[model samples]
Target: MKAILRTMGGWSQRAPTCCAVVMKHAVLWCAAMLFAALIPVVHAVAADTSLTPEASAAKMAAEHLMTAKIEWRGPSSSPKPLAGKRIAIVSCCEAADGAARASRAMVEAGKTLGWQVNVLDGRGDPQEQNKALNSAIDAKYDGIVLEFVDTTTVSDGVARALKAKIPLITLGTLRNTPDTIPDVSWDYAKHGEALANYMIWKSNGNVNALILLNTDLYVTRNGQWVGTKNVLTDPKKCKDCKVTVKEWPMANIDTQPGSIATAALQANPKINWGWCFDACMSRVSRALIASGLSSKMRGAGFDCNAESLQLIKDGQVEAVCAADPREWDAYAVIDNLNRLMQGQPTVNQGIPVRLFDKTNISTLSDYEMSHGWQGGYDFRAAYRKLWGMQK
Candidate 1:
């Protein structure tokens, strides 16, 4: 054993050059393997630290929208309100909070301008809306604002109004058809984009969202749904994001939204965010709570309803794209009608939308909070000034 050990030690001392060569190769191989492993780690770290250019731009835009001060971006045409004109508002559905607010605002705005405004609820039915439109025409209204009702649904009534030369404007028409009727509407696609940007910014672009939409409603299909789906699926904006769309009928709004959301959540446990086209987040919040994922999941919506705003206050909802300044919208529509009555060219009142969340919601007054107004601007006074009202 001693002889063998001595022989091995002698061999190691004599083979120093050969051993150094083998050790150098071994060290080089180890370093190459380490660098190869670190390639992905470095890339992942960089991905975690930085956002894609699209995402960065979207985040900045979202932040600006969320915190931007509200101002009256206007018609810029100072026209005196046409007095003694009777305006009829054929509301799509007063049961819906937004539609109700629009109707009420029109009435209030009309009164402010010394005009008589009458509201007829369509109750969310096309036939009922047709009847309301016919009734308004029969009553000899000087002007009519189709508040939240699609003109396509009541083409005959619209034709009658056109024949009667009763200037017709729309408060929230989904499609600006006939090329004759002007609409005072929030840029719905922009609203959707703002909501999408907010979601992207908030989730850091890693989003799996379930979006609820109403195919029957044009605003959802042509506006919010289009904007959200485009942003979420766009590779430039989000790399690790996906969205599932669920269509719920407007007639079944009360019951279907919750079940559809829950079923979607159950079918795909990967869904970490939920977005609704309008104020449907109120029901979706209950579903999120029931699933025991409310704390983990995020919620976003449009047309910030009082219920959904309360959800934001309670930390259940993450964000809302709010645009329903009822009185302001009403005044804008009235301004359009006034222009028509006075034979002046009607101006497009591009109402701006704002994103609201925990960060800036506290700044809203109680009235503003309830009615979904972005705080810090007096649109009512601005509209009055544009209408050439002394008060």
Candidate 2:
């Protein structure tokens, strides 16, 4: 040990001095080993807690969806239409743009099937919707399409339709019970996540966002609220993000969004992003402009309504998630009903959604922008081919 210490010390004068050198060397060796051992631990901590991985993932996912080429992703069934079939639509609210679009598209799609389609406006009243459903039932329509109306309000009428043995499907609504009714609904949660991702990617991991929701709709409660919360609050995905959620009653969804947005912005100046769950972006956009926040705060949501598209075109909003065109959605409903009429199992229809923003919105003509992503490819032709209606 003395000889080793002396060599390490380069020929120290005394044994005690050599011993001191040995002790110093021993301490340094232990420290080196400890540091080497801790290197992996340091990296592991960073891997577990760092925000880069989740942010990167969000960026890639958001970009892919933003630029994805739309096409037919639904079924390929060549189901022929039943002869002399009459279908009725019970619209929850003709005032709502989405319901109106669905009504128009359903009528058009019905013509392709050579079926007679009737629409009864619910006028945003549950009692009206119930009465409409009963009217359709009384008329003995072969099928009924419930548009944007919650099933809860028309449960009795739904039961009556079931008792009457009519094939009832829903458009832009969820199927509450499995295998009971076919619903041409959307993955609203996916829509919400797309919005969240857009904010994340645009904000670059520093998002202070406020999400507006209408608790009355199942689409908002079961999907958008859940999806947005999951992403914005996840530490792995967004380390420097703050999400504030506010509820807007369905009754006031159209009219009160602007005031609510103004209030929220006034309450929290740190919020850089504001997102509505649907086409209420019109009101929100107006509020932002009025508040002179269009340059500071960004807005986003679903339903590419004409006003929303114009806002996007004018750069008032950052982005919006657009679902399958109402035509595609209406045809999907018809396809589901056709399957039921033919005694076949109903399919999910796999409707596609895309994110639109300033980067790509200008490519669409005014008509196309008015209608949202008119099926990136020739989806109507494809659907017609699936129905064997393409002449």
Candidate 3:
């Protein structure tokens, strides 16, 4: 397991000096060399014998990471009822389909409950997010849903909202610290582990991987990276697996994943698998094909976006651990808000994360992708009943 040297809340406070940054890279390079040296020894031992019982069990466990099971279990107490309440949804950015779909879900869910819904777009700007929060507070909305906005950047705004006694629920804001606000998100670590395990299984324990990481979304991306490293480096899990990383700022991810991934593949010809924390990085498909590595490399990542699914269909990517922002997470946010409004203790709404590959891609209709992916379960009626909207 990788030991976490320090903990970072949503954002990094200070940039490292040039010397410190260089020293860090030098240390990482040394570690990578040591890891690479051991790969051949591990491969030789594995080739001599069939998988031990323990190793076989580990592989089976990895395969099972593909699907998630969720149960509501009902809230502790009845909800306070929100028939005429006003709710505001502040989105980090709608440019990304995930964020836009989630915002729409929250609005529709609120309206379904006969509540007034207001949506504010942050457009990926921290200042704009803060302004939206302030506007929501000034207007005295009964509750607020913050989607994918960095809480660290809007601490003052969150503080003000808390002072106003407006219950705050967040989706995709990565601060695990104890706060008055509640965050409704998936187990990001598990998502990463699933991706790593899928790659390991597909490669038959002989895998070399390059992970495209987004540092701006460090809270979640870092967890995924750590999970990937933990599985890839464990001798029991996959002794022959070797892994490396390339970091990109989230702002540049839209245009850089392809070039950066292409360059990494060029430098490391042995790499057979590519991984990303977000499906958006699947854009690297064109670059991988252009560089002549498309046939040799398989990719996996999180999110069930249209593009990622298309890549799976085209055979450029192998798998994706899917999440439906509109149907899964957005509903959780609304359910949590309802719990808060009614004086019920919030429950962890475990959103289902399913693995989508060629075998199952046919099950998805075009409508599902054009909107956000919806899970197998119909949760609207159950949630409405919990909120006292239905008998």
Candidate 4:
């Protein structure tokens, strides 16, 4: 002990005694052994916390001075620019609120990105839609988007699109499959339930809802209608119900208020509430007015467009189940198309759709008009942020 003390004193005298330096070196060596001893404990704790061994290994790897590390490359797919490519967009109808806004935003965005885009209006004809799709394939568009008329009709044409080696992006309500073609859309049933519940809650259970819907369009009506039907038929949900169609949506019926104004009036003398799975911009309000029922009816419809907002302003409509229609349409088709074009494997999340009330309507409308179909979601920023391209 005396000899060791004498040696320590000699070293301290020569080095001018840094106890911190000696302690740090000792602590590091001790910690190395302590951590090694705790590995089994760490493994147990990590497992109990539901972390896999691989993740635990990665965490340890991050603290190492020398590691065989691989940086995260990207999504199973890439989102490269679609510049200098022509894309074909198909719509169920040119006149409807959702289709029209999407078409406009897509055209404008494509122009900015230097891609040629052609929109083929199906005009509510499945046969015509198929024909236009055939033309798009023959014309050799780099990417083809199929907006289905019904849930199942588009599936029959999938083989044709696949055989051509062209990426067919199915938008709106579509199916889950093992095919290379990916789907893009929001949850339809949730949207329907949320809208219905909101309306029922707003009316205080005393009002009767006149449900005007299109049975043909799968995404718009068929899928949504199923949920709406469930709610309306529920004795616990809504009190009184009557379903009427001034003109079935997408019959290419001129937006004329004349044809169904009389029928709507006759269906019920005083409509406490009105609902349309449409723009419900002008004609429905007129039907209420023409039936001399405008003063009493509180109206709600799908989509938040300029005209819809105007109706809200004029107090002709209560509220529209306004999800950013432009964004819904754009993200539905564009995200997958971009993925396919760049030879990236696409991943679908249950597409997110948010309801817009009067509080947020003005902002959503402005955002859509200024930015195509993105619905305030900056795809470029979103991708970069998601990929950790930015901190």
Candidate 5:
């Protein structure tokens, strides 16, 4: 019995003295040892958050050192004159406020260039978008611009346009696939990282973040979350940060963001920061206040829409990553398409993204803030001059 006990490793220390009890106790000891062996495996699957306070501070310092300013890189010069060209503007949904504005901007740019522009509203239906593309192809439009339409969903339409040798450009949709043309949008991952970095620094690297995601917008939405998680979970970037993600169905954002955010905050009272992928969903300001966490928690997100900018100015939101989905994005798309028409290699027109906070919100005029802080730049005039619309 003593030799068998020695073979049991540390289980021998807990062995029963009586022979009758020995068998029962040995079975329980074996189960306990098996469970203990699995604990490390479970922990390894989770995010590693075991950094010393000193190490965390050092990591944050490195993050700060790497921070840089955002710059706008619009077209340096417009492509050779695009006079007498016929352009088709296909809008994903005119009911979508951002898409409407972008469509208008594209039409205005086409007018400035003496081009006949045809506007097609997809009405948020893929079939309608397909019809619009087919119509544009039949009409022999010189170029086509798509606003806020998922390229993958319209892959067949895109293939038809490509086969027709029509130059196509997409705006406000993140498409890295080869089937699509040049996509004019901000770097969503970088935008998300900026928001996360702000929260981490503001909380002194001790942040429990609740990320609100819109899973409907798959690529851009997930890309933003990836950036946020990468910084929040990395021990070298934020040692004391913890992240919990909750995805809201796309249809629920307009009406349910407040309620969903309230429930999430109530369930996880330790959350010190709330990060949203789109500023439109950041309408949870009232929910944050109602929970009495207004003073304790800070929120940041993308888009500098009117509500979000006001929240930032009023101290309800900590930061907003601003991009001009209304105008600049459309201009970039037109500029690139023009380049492609002129036999020049199309380039990714770098749209600028700025983080707006209380400190700088007051400095912006009302018009600028209302336009999502995009009024500060004059990309329209610059592009117009490049296209030779102005001297």
Candidate 6:
């Protein structure tokens, strides 16, 4: 590597290049080369030692590119990285924990792709999230990614942003209106319906299914309420499988599901199947036990929380309808950001949903190690390949 020297108010010193030194002085030039070689080792050590994402990014850039800003604060900058861009992640579901991981990944990806990215957590509050959206639009970010908490009210923010000519993409849910907010998310209804079909197929139309349909009125705008309704209404697919649903509010899974299950079993003693929407898979299992019928029950749900995976291993639960929640959360937003940035049309990501049973649950012990959560996406990369990388 060559080094170019920029002298200021003193003796000449060589500027560093790819490992070559450019000092006029002969003795010092050899010394500089040794130092340059050592620089790589030093930075490598820093990368290993560093903990924070920002520090790691900076260290990586400094070592590899000789000049990189891992610290830019806005989208359009000297390096013009998406890392500097301001992104608001609006979530009503408990996708934050996973989405945060995605955000970290996005930061690294942005550093590589030359983006300055920041994520705003909206906590499922529509008005509060709306204010954040307005700020991003006013700041004139190169792109904006929005996750919806309320399907209807949030539409106003999308309309306003689009009216201001901002590209706004929704993640994890879709707004059917042509209000110009292109959303990239999984069609959640497909997941719900798939689970319903699988349960019916396994049971040969005889399983009494108790469904834990998560409340979306206070959570996300994913139409969980409507989606579950649609998925259950179809009979040709579900055949003779009897289905019942209870709207479980957030965090009450620990208490509410047991009562719901007890009553359902009391009213319908042959209830052999239970399905909770996401993380509360274990709670539903316990609910079955509370009903004094754990022996006859085989349960299923989404997400790979530690307790839930163990339930799968112990045979208390039949399978998990697992999705990479963090990948779903993070890229759901970033995919939208890219669409907005490029003035391209956007659609739902339709993130893949998989069924994890006992045969494969142990092999996925990484989820056990990782708070029972999965990170990799089967859909994002595939979609990227089909649609081309976002600008």
TM-score of each: 0.81, 0.81, 0.77, 0.67, 0.73, 0.60
Candidates 1 and 6 compared: the better one by lDDT is: 1
Question: How well does model 5 score by local distance difference test?
Answer: 0.69
- Candidate 4 runs further than 4 Å off: 1-77, 154-157, 176-181, 239-249, 255-258, 290-292, 349-351, 357-391
For candidate 4, lDDT tens digit of each residue in 142-231?
988766445255555556767888877776655533345566665576556555655554544444666666555666665666666676
Per-model clash counts, in order, read 0, 0, 1, 1, 0, 25
Q: Among all windows of ten consecutive residues in candidate 2, which has the lowest summed lDDT? A: 317-326
Which regions of candidate 5 are displaced past 4 Å?
A: 1-72, 92-100, 116-140, 286-297, 322-326
Residue range 185-263, candidate 3, lDDT tens digits: 6666766777767676666677798777765553556566677788888888888889887876555656687788788
Clashes of 3: 1
Q: What global local distance difference test value does model 3 have?
A: 0.71
| Residue 80 in model 5: lDDT | 68
In order of TM-score, best first, we have 1, 2, 3, 5, 4, 6
Model 4 clashing residue pairs (backbone): 327-373
Indicate the residue-level lDDT of 62 in model 1. Answer: 82
Clashing pairs in 1: none
Question: Compared with the true structure, what per-residue lDDT tens digits does model 2 show for residues 295-357?
Answer: 767887777766777778788754555555666788788889888878887797777777778
TM-score of 2: 0.81
Report the lDDT tens digits of candidate 1 across residue range 264-382: 87788788888874556778788778778677567887777677777888897445555556566777888888888888877877566778788878877897767767335677787
lDDT of 5 by residue, 317-380 (tens): 4454434445777777778888878877777677766566675667567776666555456777
